[model samples]
Target: MDQKKEIKKTNDQIINSFSTELQTKVKTSISIIEEAVARYGYEGLSLSYNGGKDCLIILDLIHSIATGILPTNLTNPEKLKEIVLFYLRDEDDFEEIDEFVNTSLRSYDFRNYTKFATNSLKQGLIYILKEYPKLQGIFLGTRTADLKGRKQPIFAPTNGDWPESIRISPIMEWNYSDIWDYLLTKKVSYCELYDQGYTSLGLKSQTKQNPLLKQKNGEFLPAWVLSQKSSERDGRILSLSNSSTSTQIH
Candidate 1:
């Protein structure tokens, strides 16, 4: 009982802290983001364009702050230049993410590249380091409220080994409702997945569509597909292929 009380207290304190931080910074987040662009030099900046609502809002803010004079042209729709958009398709869902990105965002620089966050971060760092050595950093749309079982991040991550490029999150203290309010006031165009009941979007194979995920720890995959005929065939073929490859190596 004592331990439970302590845990409850900790959770309350964290929520309070985030509420306070957001109250203080909500008005100034845009200025701070603009300052980052000026301080870092726009030419050295790039956003990790994921084509999600959060990422789209950030990109829009960057454009607003720059007053139409942003350094990089990849994400700029006016430039028609290519920027990498890390995404994967859901074969079972029978819908392409690009169909949404194209019709909604009206852009083509959206490259379908990233399949997972962990792997994408590694590859993004390597690509920047190798291709654009002078690039300063990348911005992410991560928020304190987004983490499932995390202590909200307050400062930049430093102790862990990272690429020379900096990673920043200006809206880290903001919540989902806060973001929605801002989007409404600013009238920014956003991805349509949110209306369809997806809080986060990823590969169709990995992503699930349910708004109650946070409350229920819900399973996204359909139960009917569990023992489907194609999956069974693929399983056998995969096993046989592995065995044959191992025998050849031997």
Candidate 2:
């Protein structure tokens, strides 16, 4: 099928597939992206994508609205050259994760994707700011329940000591169930780690299959079925089950 026709079909499907609650969240998130574009222009915006489930949903949301939201210069945001994309590359990253990122950049036609060599999220942000001086905002795939997510506003600003840039948490209001519902209902592509019971992905050494999901047959369940929402990170070696803050940022 032609690119134009395919986009139209997918957009219609996306609108009809999600539940009413999820549709509302999707609309608000897209509106946030639109607001960011209005404030900084498309070229001045960026996205922090790491081939994870949360970020994958963010990417698909952008793709869903690309034909209408983005300028005509790129034909479609699927060309993905107008707005820069940043990935914090790490030495300890899972090979599967890296492969997914590489495949997605190609499949999405992300012509402006850049990778930072460091593992620290703080350091990666610093690197991107130094590399792209004109950037005014970067879309983050944050949700209401993530670490410090409940405390921050939708358009959270960087810390006083860090480089200044608008952190656009478009899906800040979405919850854990909403995340899974959007991904599965929309038929969106996601990383394979989730199906293997790694509910919260961290470094390869630190992350494991969630024991909460372990079955009597010595198999584990999918990430979405883990009953206790707070135990999502229990698979991690440094899981802070007792603390309110997240021990590791996926």
TM-score of each: 0.55, 0.85
Misplaced by over 4 Å in model 1 are: 1-26, 68-96, 102-119, 148-161, 211-250
Instruction: Provide the lowest-lDDT 10-residue window in model 2.
Output: 240-249
Reference-based lDDT, residue 111, model 1: 29
Model 1, 1-250: lDDT tens digits are: 6964765565444334434544355435555555555556655555565565556666665544333322222233232222233332224322545465455444433322333222235455655556656656566666554443455343244235556666566676665555555555445555555444454455454455542422354433321123222221121212222211111000
> Residue 10 in model 1: shift from native, Å?
43
- Against the unseen true structure, what C-alpha lDDT does each candidate score? 0.45, 0.74
Clashing pairs in 1: 86-114, 87-114, 90-204
Model 2 RMSD in angstroms: 4.0
lDDT of 1: 0.45
